[model samples]
Target: MAELQIAEIPYEDGGIRYRYARRLSEDGTRWIRDGRFTAYHPNGAIASEGTYSDGIEQGLWRDYHDNGRIAAEGQYDRGQESGVWRYWDSDGRDVNG
Candidate 1:
C-alpha cells in the first residue's frame, strides 16, 4: 500500500499576488484535493475558505467580501451546495432578509 502524501500548493494569479492555497493528496493514482482550501483576494483578504474530499467540496464553506465581511456561507455535500445558505453585505448586514 502506498502512503498518501499531502502537498501544499500556493498559487498566484497573473503574477500579482497569492490567489489560493490548496492541499492535495496523492492516492497512488492521481492527486486530488483532500483538505483545507483557502482563497485570497487580490488585496490579501480571504475570499473563501472550505474543505475538500477527494477533489469534492464537503462541509462548511464561507466566502467573504474584499472588505473582510462575510458575503456568503453554507454547507457542501459531495461538491454540491446543501442546506440553507446565508448572505451578508459588505457591511456585515444580513442580506437574506
Candidate 2:
C-alpha cells in the first residue's frame, strides 16, 4: 500500500478564498482521496467535512454555514447520500422541525 499523503489546496473565486484539504493515496496510477476530507468556505469557516474511502465519500458528513453554524449533516455511502439527513437554517434553527 502506498503511503497516504495529505494535500491542501486553496482556491479563489471572485476574490473569495476557498480551501480543500484531503488525504490522498497513490493507487499505482494516480492519487485518490482515501481518508478525511474537509473544505473551507470563502470566509475560512468549515464548509463541509467528511471521510472518504477509495476516493468515494463514506460515513458521516457535515456542512456548515458561513456564520459558523451547522447547515446540514448526514451519512454517505459510496459517495451517495444515505440514511437520515438533518438541516439547519443559517441562524442555527432546525429546518426540519
The most accurate candidate by lDDT is: 2
Please report, in order, the local distance difference test score of every candidate based on alpha carbons: 0.75, 0.80
In angstroms, the error of model 1 at 39 is 0.2
lDDT by residue (1-97, candidate 2, tens digit) is 6677777776655432433334434446667787888888877888898888888989999999989999999999998999999999999899886
The TM-score leader among the candidates is: 2
Candidate 1, overall lDDT? 0.75
Q: Which stretches of candidate 2 lie over 4 Å from their true place?
A: 13-27
Give Cα distance to truth, residue 91, candidate 1, Å.
1.1
Clash tally for model 1 = 0
Reference-based lDDT, residue 42, model 2: 79
Q: Assess every candidate by TM-score.
A: 0.74, 0.83
What are the RMSDs of all candidates, in order?
Answer: 3.7, 3.0
Per-residue C-alpha lDDT of model 1 across residues 1-97, encoded as one tens digit per residue: 2334444345455422323323434445555666677777777788888888767989999999999999999999999999999999999999898
Q: Which window of ten consecutive residues has the lowest lDDT sum in model 2?
A: 15-24
